[model samples]
Target: MSTTPSDASRPSLIRWPERLGYGVGDTACCLFWAIVSSYLNLFYTDVFGLAPAALAWLLLITRIWDAAFDPVVGMIADRTSTRWGKFRPWILWSIVPFMVAEIALFTTPHLGPTGKLVYAYITYSVVMLIYSAINVPYGALLGVITDDSAERTTLASYRFIGAFVGNFIVQGILLYLVQALGRGNNRLGYTLAVTILACGSGLLLFYVFLSTNERIQPPQAENSVRRDLRDLLGNRPWLVLFAMGAISLVYLTLRQVASVYYVTYYMGDRGLIPAFLLAGTAFSILGAMLAPWMARRVGCKKRTFILLTLWAAACNAATALAGPRDLVLIFGTQMLGSMPLAAIFPLMGSMFADTADYGELKFGRRATGLIFAGSTFSQKTGGAIGAAIVNLVLSSVGYVANAKQSASVLGGLRHLMGTLPAAGGLLVAGLALFYEIDTKREREIGAAIAARVRSVAAGRPSDS
Candidate 1:
């Protein structure tokens, strides 16, 4: 176990620049992911001409690989001790391979069904696993950055800002890039868009590596991997977080997959997709900025639950009510729906850090990496399930490749894009009800734990 300093002696503030840089890197990575998540299914079904079910299965199987790989990456990151810091080294080394794999995944050659599935499986699986190596550690690094609750919230806000920027770059710019590069060849457009994504992603990774420093150090503990896994599984708060994350995955995945279809098919205006996305992104940013204030005033759990539920209901109802002529209303509802998402994502990161602290207090070792890895694994699994559901639903609605869909199909697609996600969002909000860790409770726990650590280090014993 690592020795602890007294709470009174802890730093009052975290450096803002470091936090911003971290967010920048996170934004870049997420931008690339958003591109993949938002457009890849469409590309596969329409451009690559692969079966929707096949694509779904491929995504599902790759996620199994991601789940299997997460813990291993976490363990490796925890044990790693390079001059660059445990997490930073992974971030540093992963840049090239991550970019390369992303490019390859998007640039796969036109092939027959089996060949296309094989190409998708090999490239996507590799990209996911490699990305995990970097992402697990990066996620874990959030807890190590600061122990101050206020500072952590600030950091999370900046992080979400980066995420929003990344979303903007990908969803906003990449669409235009594809059109420019495709020049009538849709496949070429995807390939060029991915190339641009790779460059942006690489630059962001470099910025993160150059700008951030790891101020907090992990405690040296003598547990084997087996024991670490056991300790992680024993954490109740973290278990709840994982469940919540799964629900978030379902919500985000559905929204991403639906965006292209909603604008292209339903609205009959593919160009409007970027505008709708930007509106949603702007709303999400506003919501995230307000979240910390809301949490402090009403309590994080309560505010989260209420906001998410309302957002979900509004989103679903808007889709149900809007007709083709009511595109304005539909976009308005989407912007409204984004409010909770922006608030929720950043809060979720902070909550995971809180869970890490709780786990440390109970187990006497800091297993930040493992705890975050579990969260990441759950998220990836949920994404996989979401992808599967989207594919299956589209297929069931009689969607055909490179052809106009029937009215029934379009109706069903709208429902999946709108109501289904709203329901998933509500389900996640309901899960938030089970969370027992309020902001007040968390502060108390932090103080008690810090005092206990201080006493123990001073060769005295204290009951927390």
Candidate 2:
């Protein structure tokens, strides 16, 4: 629990297995994550048979809860002092609850639409709540696990690569699995898939809890909620990341929801869904793998993020130009686009760790849990809005479930896939331009924070 001089003064080398486990933890989280992000829209509309407009209302209403709760959960996690550490205990607490909530969320009751809507509201809210419990802490782990800048980036890469593995498992094979396992009862198929994935997620998260440690402790004197909020709001680097996190999820959620409709309606092939999502997941993995190397090649993570996000934006926009049935053009453009979007996940994560340090050095408070909670806040707030917009647009364009889509609906899918997400990516690029923490500030902050922590532990004045 106490900091050693070496732990405070230098970058601690995270072992390969620990890094791998940290990554695996995210992979586990993504099993649930990808399920909600990729399939929940389709499941709610097609399988559960909810009307588009109704589902839009559901998403919009529930997002309010998501936006509000993440920071509270983060604050709780930050204040929690445990022998297991500040963040890891939440992972342990969440495993069983997460399993139950996820299964309940995906389950379809035989109630009427009104009753079912109520069921959805309660279950969906529970799932998102538990997800924040595990995830906000896990994300905060990145800042605490190691303060080394390069190691944070590497860990983030591992984290997201693991995330896409979960993404690939669900996105790539869930449809086929549903088809095979459902045997014409698609609802049962979904239930079965969630059950299997949920069990696996619990086990992997247990491993994450046992394997990881919260090494970089927060500063000793952070107690005021008002001051914490003020510091978080005032931190400029954090402000930029907060915006980027929101836009990034907007980009991701819109594209993910649109991809299904694009294949099912636009291409007239429901069968291609798995492969298309698989391709995107594969490219996402590749992008995550190359993120660290790409950052190194460009000699700066910030520049790499800007360049790659712009590239991804261009690729998404190009998809609009392709003919609906042109598989080659569609796949090629998306795969190209997915790589950069994927690349930015790690970049954004590492940059967040930087913000934690910068906020601490600048504001004299280390709200790692609260700061990282903003990442989840942005994700849920942004993702929920994006999902709502897509559904509402589908309704506005006269989308009908299980029937032939109108030309207006088909065209809307293209714009959702292309224009909206491209615009989100471009916004990410533009926001990165305003980010002020470069390598120079990273070192200064890391050093200053290290000295500050070291001095506190030694009961002396901080050289920082």
Question: All candidates: CA RMSD in angstroms?
Answer: 2.0, 1.6
Q: List pairs with backbone clashes in candidate 2.
A: none
Highest TM-score among the candidates is held by which one? 2
The lDDT, on a scale of 0 to 1, for candidate 1 is 0.78
Per residue, candidate 1 scores C-alpha lDDT tens digits across 205-320 of 88888887665655446768888888888887788778988877876787788778877887777778888888888887787777777667765654665576667566766776
Relative to the true structure, candidate 2 has a C-alpha RMSD (angstroms) of: 1.6
Residue 321 error, candidate 2, Å:
0.6
Candidate number with greatest lDDT: 2
Q: Give TM-scores for every candidate, taking all chains together and pairing residue i with residue i.
A: 0.95, 0.97
Write model 2 residue lDDT over 1-464, tens digit each, in one string: 12467775557769999998899998999899888888888899998988999999998888869778989988999999989999999999999999999988988999999998999999998888888899999999998898788999999999999999999998876777777888999899898879889999999999999989788766667598898889999999888888988888887889887788889999899888888889988999999999999999998888999999899999989998877778898999879999998999899999988888888888777888998898889878888888998998999999988889999999999999988888888888888889998877777777777677777877998755
Q: How does residue 318 of candidate 2 score in lDDT? A: 91
State residue 302's C-alpha deviation in candidate 2, in Å.
1.3
